[model samples]
Target: MSYLPDRVPLHGPKFAADPHAAYAELRRMGPVGRVELSPGAPAYLVTDYRAALDLLHDTDTWSKDTRPWQQNQPADSPLVPMLGWRPNALFNDGKAHERYRSVITDSYALIEPHQLRRQVSKVANQLIGEFAAAGEADLIGQYARRLPLLLFHAQFGADDQEGPRLEADMAGMLDSQPDKAIQANINFANYITELIRSKRLQRGQDLTSWFMDHPAALTPDELADQIVLTMLAGNEPTANLIGNALSRMLSNPAYYSSLSSGALTAHDAINDVLRNEPPMANYSAHVPRHAVHFHGTWIRPHELVLVSYHAANTEPGPTADEKTAGGDDGAHLAWAAGPHSCPVKKPATLIATVAIEQLTRRLHDLELGVPRNELRWRPGGFHRALAQLPARFTPIAPDPDGVSPWTSSSPYSSTRQDKTWSPKPPACATSGPLYG
Candidate 1:
């Protein structure tokens, strides 16, 4: 494949600071263009909507497994950790992919949507109650990141304390720091391994037990892989989804008021965020089955090809503005498409919506603590997430019964010190909370 001159780099502060501008620059070259993923790992980015759909749907020409490409690279290659082969559905194709995907979708279906919403609301309020007395909090660190983990932990039959540990380690793994990610991967695996062993001896009604007793009857290693996949898949993207939507709500008063005043809905705000700033921004990584020329770019067999969900959604054209509103079928690629598209999008959306509504209603005066421009986002080739979202609100009494309902019975529970009851920070002028 002929290397494109001045390939766009998808790392560092410049790209992380303003990725939309970078996408605009890449769109000028063409739909698909050569780009450097890291120092030496180069891949083709699909920045056009139509081309992205083509690539995702044409799985015969593109495979999800990365071993074909990794086979020739040195053992210490950087790409190995991020895109290395796994036995789970995310890294398989054809019959194997179908088998793994069935287990996930089926297990997830066991939980009702309303149940999921209730659980999310319960978790959301409990989290809010923790910092309600403090008057100040980093929403991303304290609330957004923890909510999904807590909910997932309950489902996994793990205790609440594991949530924070999983949240921190997963954050490190997702960010582009290789050393931290390597250690995190190992630590995360060990944690899941123990969870699996515990479940094997004493199963419960949780998703973990459901998977173990399922018809497929996954082995221990397979169960751990599936659990780790679900945790990693569910954690970062959901955290980012909640964080990004909150950022949009707090930053744009007009938009925030519209949603709160019944002029718009949380669903609308979520769709807008999904279109403009997708959680998994540059993901759905695949490798071509063989050397193929696509959109004037000669991509070799087994070369990394990433579909730019953010870029494709924002690609300038006649229909670029379609994503600003909801009810548009075939509008955004945020949930992706094809056989490998996210199956849990509905639940994910519900969690984000319920979270936003619960936080706004409970606090009633939440507003950004720092200037919008001062917010920092971690740099990476895949996810688009906020590093933190500090905010201020009226201080209220902390919930006396703030402990998670699932904490008491789970074998994985931990007795971490309670800090949510800390004293409130000094008061400041606060914007009146908006309600619909």
Candidate 2:
């Protein structure tokens, strides 16, 4: 009898092209699997939610600064020279990363809850209103893409002219073309270095100025480095969350009606969307400590380990269902695990919640103007999102005095599935109160 071929399934570009299905298959393969990494670094894949969570935050065991798959370029040398390069906090580990987080926390999380909520609500409504009026628009390129950039611009006090250029540069950085990311990274770094210097000369009352004041604690160069990382790390996730969440609303016709019927809160919908498809499919670190006992394999040090955030979010358990219980599954490792999990978790969540709620309450029907299958999604970025999401919808008309309650009755059918954002308020300029 001829020997049978191994039935093992292979996942890589073939599966990464559309990772959800592959994730399901990987989930079935126990909590862990092995895969070859760039430069042939031996690596283990963590698909199990439980194990992945422990593996991520066990800082003692796993580290963010694991040895590079190939070799570590001198810290003085440029790590990303293509678009631009800035070390920021992600490039290091231990106390250094901690200090970086503290600075961001004060601005993002230290604000009083009342003020944060008010500001988020205001920004959400103002942005949604402009897009709602347009009747149809691309959610990713128009609203989802613009909102975070504006917020960051205001937060950092970067020039209004910078948003469009920065977004374009970010897109280029994600290109699959050889050396594109590197080129984009380098260019971006150089630009940020100069921007930081200018901000220092005439300090303004914004996040950038805050950094200028804290150079003793974080140095001007380090802050310049952080400027790039913070922008990249935050914007991409927001875009995906918006696009991915909108995808859910379109898929589940009942979702809009449920929300319009006052059965679900905006927060509830966001939780579901994140669980369904977070912006990032996965997060990787070089296993800085080197050789780790992965699945009983001695695997020598310097091996790469890939943690599947997408799988971890979908982990089947009550823990992941905290959305129902009114708590974010602290168990979901999408932000990574432990105290070191995504530093801006609180603010990112707030912004996402506010944007979704504002839009959900103001619109009636949301129909995709373009074929869903034809939509393009960008890959190879730190996060994943649509290159564009073409859509159309009708906004609820505002009341006589203008401000309508978030739960106002829409003349349009409760079941709309459109993705849009514009600079004008929606036909309906109603008050979009917070829900769930």
Candidate 3:
């Protein structure tokens, strides 16, 4: 007998707590099914691997525009903060998407990989230096969260003072409620406008300057929007990618040993994380140009269609041969696909790799400060992120040169017992802040 799964609610603490288990249930019901995003926003979620690819690639039939759906949505809906229309490539299609995407992708491509690696290493080392001496630190706030922001700031000609503010504003925009998120968006827009103006007056050796010279000749507003899109695309997902990979390494003894012993490469670990728990767990929302029957489910025209990367990667129907035979080793939708695929994927991967490699190499004995299960997953359906990656390593001396780039006020201190990190700590520990 065929089974009919109950309609699942995609928002709230329950879904965020253990989304994979929920996806497993959804797959059992059917590859495509109805689900509510937040309270009143209901949409169809695509859970199967084959179906997701089809939906992502068929942009001709499934446009990125959401005007059809937004016309009826309440002004105060929480999901609107996330899925609402914007002028950037993320929200447009056809010639507009091409124009925005051309400039953004070309600007990103100008940064040579080797040069980019040097910058990533520099930022990684500076961040590690700041926290390494403490012997115990929250990796998420101190390292994972700060590394990408600082790198982006450096490229945008922003200084250390701007780093924290940019991080906070973007975080608020990504994960806050409707009111706070909208305000954060406004603050960020103003900040970008100023940055672009500064670049126009005196061109710098940075992406912002390169963007100004591009042939697209974007208006000031378009320039600011594109920069915001590029920064947001790389910062949040890459941070979460690093965090999720570190969590897996610390929590699973076998994976840790493989990484330490060089049996598994950093790329391998990254691929594993991308497949099992992607940074953007639920994204690539598309609106069908017309009402159509997809995989036995009728989706209305312009309905918000979301792909669950976590579920697609874990679908149980594919045979071992099917899984390993044709697709690329990293054949996961974590980087997304089609024309709108992440443009900075190469740099993002390199950054995550160097960050993980540098941290483990510097603190050879680093271990999780809290129990594996006790680490709180932040509440959000759009991202799979750990609240804090508390970890402990042997204390080390501070840099003699006093040249560390970190702030004088260290966020981590050596308080935990001096032992190898444990995967089983008491459950009463509080969640750490998202940023230092």
Clashing pairs in 3: 371-423
Ordered by TM-score, highest first, the candidates read 3, 1, 2
Predicted candidate 2 versus true structure: per-residue lDDT over 1-436, tens digit per residue: 5432222222234444576655555555567756433222234667776667667666776666544533543333322231122345665667887677666654443244444455555555556555666688777777787777667765676776776666666766766574776677677776677667778677665667665555236776677766766787788787678777776665555665554455666566667766656676665553636566655445455555667777667766655445233223454555665555667766777777767666665664666677667666664423556777777776544333334322245453223222222112112112222222
Better of 1 and 2 by TM-score: 1
- Greater TM-score among 1 and 3 belongs to 3
Candidate 1 lDDT, tens digit per residue, 260-288?
Answer: 45455667779888988999999888989
- Please report the candidate that would top lDDT against the real structure: 1
Q: How well is each residue in 1-436 modelled by candidate 3, as lDDT tens digits?
A: 7765557777778888889767877776677867777776788889988788778778768888888888889977777756877788888988999888877666666565666666777778777878777889999999898899888987777645777788788777865566788888898887787788787788766778777777777887788878888888778788999999998888777666544455666677788889888999888878899988888888889688888887887777785357543333345778777777776677788889988887776676788998899998887678888889999987666555545433334333212222111111211112221111
Q: Which lDDT values do the candidates have, in the order given?
A: 0.77, 0.59, 0.76
The parts of candidate 1 lying over 4 Å away from their true place are 1-4, 172-180, 258-262, 320-329, 403-436
Please provide TM-scores, in order, for all candidate models, with all chains considered together: 0.86, 0.75, 0.87
